[model samples]
Target: MPTALITGATAGIGAAFARRLAADGFSLVLVSRDETRLAEAAERLKQKYGVAVDVLPADLATDDGLERVEARLREGVDCLVNNAGFGHPGHFLEVPLEDEVRMLKVHCEAVLRFTLAALPGMRARGRGAVINVASVAAFFTRGTYSASKAWVVNFSESTAAEVGDPKIRIMALCPGFVRTEFHQRASMDVSGIPGFLWLQADAVVNEAMRDLALGRTVSIPDPRYKAIVAVGRLIPRGLTHRISAMIGRK
Candidate 1:
């Protein structure tokens, strides 16, 4: 079976990827900060899917952690999911400079380093894939988080074009308001987001997998979100940012 390494594999989209890939018969290397949580999640996947699961406990924000994960990537995995990320709770001015930099470290630097580490092996092998989990916020003006994710989307697209390999794939998965620990962990209130706009994590992953298999470079899961992005693109960016700010302030 092919092997897959997923960063931030403890929960949300990363955990969902672990489950899906395991069910698809891929051996898994799960990377996350919490050793206990990684072990527990690995056990669960091993039991459920009978797929081999390895845990790599590392914080993506630091040098030591990034180096450890980078070394693993060089060893060669057929798939890499750069899904580890977090969000700040308040306005840009309210959040500390250190916190902003940490977000960049995880969302941008880690993704860039890990992708670069993994791709050479993949290119040599003539087949592999990388999925970077960005957010729909990437299209908007949501401060550092969106800016970092925007980088992810552009990087994924450019890399895919540069590689120009039918077998080696790079894609960005952008989901809108999925029901994960994402907002809870970020301590953001989601009450103002409409019920219809919310998405389920499992469904989002399913769509993503389908898109990847179809060789799509960017996968935006739901039709509602697809429409939103299309509309967001058509309108003036200032208007989109204002509307996004109003919703986010709630």
Candidate 2:
């Protein structure tokens, strides 16, 4: 069976992906910062799916942490899911410099490094898939979070273009307001939003995986979100920024 390496596999979309892939008969290597949770997740998946599961605990924000994951990537995994990321809510100026730097490391540097490290082996094999968990926030200039997601989007698109003829597939999965620990962990205020507007984690992961299998370069999970992105492109940048700022306050 093919093996999949997934970061942030302890919770949210990452965890959902783990379950889905396990059910599809893939063995797994799960990466996350929480050792206990990681072990628990791995154990559950292994027991539930009868597939081998390995837990790798590392903070993608730190160099040592990223190096640990990179070392594993060199082992020639078949699929890589760069799903580790988090966000902090506030005006850019109000957010601490350290937090922003850490976000950059986790959301940007770690992703780029892992993809780079894994690409050589994937290219050599001529058959592999990479999924970067981005966000519909990439369509808006909400904050540094959205900016980082935009980077993921462009990176995946560029990679697809660079290796279009090869079987190496790179895709960005962009889902809006996923029903996960994301809001609570980020301390983001979502008081005004209705619960129905949020997409479930499993649904998002399922759609993304389907799209990846179909060789789509980018997959936005919700139809509403796809419409939002479509409308966003037609609007002027200034208007988009203003709308984003308004939503950020809610």
Candidate 3:
């Protein structure tokens, strides 16, 4: 069975990926900050899917954590999912700089380092894929969160071009608002967000897997989100920014 390493594997989209991939017969290495939660998640996956699971507890926000994960990536896995991330409840100016920096570390630096570490082994084997979990926020401006994700999209595309190997697939997954711990953890009020805007984690993962198989470098899971992103690109920047600002407000 192919091996896969996933960050933030204890919850939300990360957990969805774990379940989906395990069912598909992939040996899993689950990375998260909480050891107890990681162990619980791994145990559940093993019992449910009958697949081997490794729980790797590490805070991707720290250099030590990044190094540990990078080392594992260098050891080789058929697939890597950089899905660990969080959001701030406050607007940009109101949020602390330390929090913003931490977000960058997890969203940008860890993604960069982990992908870099994984590619060499994949290049040698000539077959592997890395899915960078970005957000539809990447297409619009929602403060540091969107900015970091936009970097992810650009970085994924640019890296794909540079790698120039069809076998070494690199893709950015841009999912819209999914019902996850994300909003709750960030304490963001979602009353203004329409019901139709919400997405299921499993559905998003299913589309992402299909898109990856089809060799799509960028996977925007939902049709609604795909259209939204398309239209977002067509609109003027000032208008889009204004809309993003409004959406970010509680």
Clashing pairs in 1: none
TM-score of each: 0.98, 0.96, 0.98
Task: Give the number of colliding residue pairs in candidate 2.
Answer: 0
Q: Which candidate ranks first by lDDT, i.e. highest?
A: 3
lDDT per residue as tens, model 1, 84-129:
9988777888889999999999999999999999999999999999
Per-residue lDDT of 91 in model 2? 81
lDDT of 1: 0.93
Worst 10 residues of 3 by lDDT: 241-250
List model 3 lDDT by residue over 16-117, tens digit each.
Answer: 999999999999999999999999999999999999999888999999999999999999999999999999986899999999999999999999999999
Clash number by candidate, in order: 0, 0, 0
Kindly report which residue stretches of model 1 are placed more than 4 angstroms away from their true locations once superposed: none
State the TM-score for model 2.
0.96
Q: Which of candidates 1 and 3 is the stronger one according to lDDT?
A: 3
lDDT of 2 by residue, 1-250 (tens): 9989999999999999999999999999999998999989989998999999998899999999999999999888889999998878778888899998898888889889999889888888888888999899898997788999999999999988987845888999999888788877888787777777789999999899889878899999988889999999999999999877766441
